[model samples]
Target: MSLDTTTLLAIVAMALVTYVTRIAGLFVADRLVLTGRAKAAFDAIPPAVLVAVIAPTALTTGWVEAIAAAITAVAAFRLPLLGTVAVGVISVVLLRNVL
Candidate 1:
């Protein structure tokens, strides 16, 4: 698929906005003294962001996607991150086409 000018410009705009906000936040936060609770919350950022990005799409797609996501979640505890993702993607694709 070819990206048109509008799509390219939109992507650039999004990138610029993301960088500006991230940099500004870092600049501001660097000067602050973080407390214990705040530090704990900061440490939770990765998983919280992952869930925020993944949960809605996984839940809304269909039962196949939901089951795949559930399996991925369980697999995540026992398998490597890459393996869990592979299981989820394969299951979702197979289930979607089969049923």
Candidate 2:
């Protein structure tokens, strides 16, 4: 099937935007002088991002999710990150079904 001119233009526009965003991210990262606190914060970004994303969802979902999050927080201190996530997910599933 042939794509219309408008569709083709839209696809090209999206491709350019995607490429520009990726290039801009690299350019900005190269310019940043991450030292001291900045370096520490940058290193913490992945976990911080996860908490920022997960916290809101956990809070808004039902009691099961909040309970799972609480349990996960405790497990996180003892387990690895992936282990914490797995425990949290399995707990959620069990809580959802059992409660």
Candidate 3:
């Protein structure tokens, strides 16, 4: 019911820690390098990581949704990047509304 000093300090400390960690990325970024194969691997990493995380969630939710999502993902992979994203969003929105 009351805001104690310890609780306020803990919240402040947590915020400061989060801010420091995020800003640390910029400090070290200039020292980091992605060359040749490393750059290619880095490019693929995000999509692969995203699919690994999203695929399981979609599967657990529903097979039909997963199939629909797969169709959208394939379109995203083959088409122009912005066009793919637009088609994917429209497909999912339509699927949700109509199906």
**Could you say which candidate leads in TM-score?**
3
lDDT of 3 at 79: 93
Best by lDDT: 2
Tens digits of per-residue lDDT, candidate 2, 1-50, equal 98899999999999999999999999999999989998998999998998
Model 1 per-residue lDDT tens digits across residues 1-99: 898999999999999999999999989988988889998998899989998999999999888888888988988889988898898888888888998
Q: Which residue pairs in candidate 3 have backbone atoms (N, alpha carbon, C) closer than 3 angstroms, thus clashing?
A: none
TM-score of 1: 0.62
TM-score of structure candidate 2: 0.69
TM-score of each: 0.62, 0.69, 0.70
Best first by lDDT, ranked? 2, 1, 3
lDDT of 3 by residue, 1-99 (tens): 899999999999999999999899788766879899978987998889988998888778876567677877889768987987787677777787877
Clashing pairs in 2: none
Give the clash count for each candidate: 0, 0, 0
Q: Name the lDDT of candidate 1.
A: 0.90
